[model samples]
Target: MDTHEWQKSSYCQEGEACLHVAAVTTAETVHLTESADPAHSILSTTPAAFGALLRVLRDDDRG
Candidate 1:
């Protein structure tokens, strides 16, 4: 597996283990995982798809 510079979510509380995200250098895929159990679960998606997901989530928050 390729090593990535994972970044924790800013929305996470201080000292709380929460969502982390990283971009794959070899491809257009982005990787998402939880800081508390990174080895147990991970999600991979393309940047475009991830962007669409975020847009939908934002829209939902407004509705």
Candidate 2:
């Protein structure tokens, strides 16, 4: 709800379009959205699932 403090991805280049994410501790969920479209939609996932996603993405970039 009101506690969503969205943060831009560190890998994002200087621009209006990029990934933004937030963690809602009360719900134990992670939230994701696009900076350029924050109002249009949002994606929510559990912390464990979000961690798995980051690991996979990191591994893909390393390969």
> Which candidate should be chosen as best, given TM-score against the real structure?
2
Question: What value does the lDDT take at residue 56 in candidate 1?
Answer: 100
Model 2 stretches with alpha carbons more than 4 Å out: 1-3
Q: List the lowest-lDDT window of 10 residues for candidate 1.
A: 33-42
Per-residue alpha-carbon lDDT of candidate 2 for residues 36-59, written as tens digits (9 for 90 to 100): 875748889999999999999999
| lDDT, candidate 1, 1-63, per-residue tens | 247888877778876478888988689888988877746478999999888988998899899
**Per-model TM values vs. the true structure:** 0.77, 0.86
User: What lDDT does each candidate get?
Assistant: 0.81, 0.87
Task: Quote model 2's TM-score.
Answer: 0.86
- RMSD value for candidate 1: 2.3
| Residue pairs with backbone atoms closer than 3 Å in model 2 (clashes) | none
lDDT of 2: 0.87
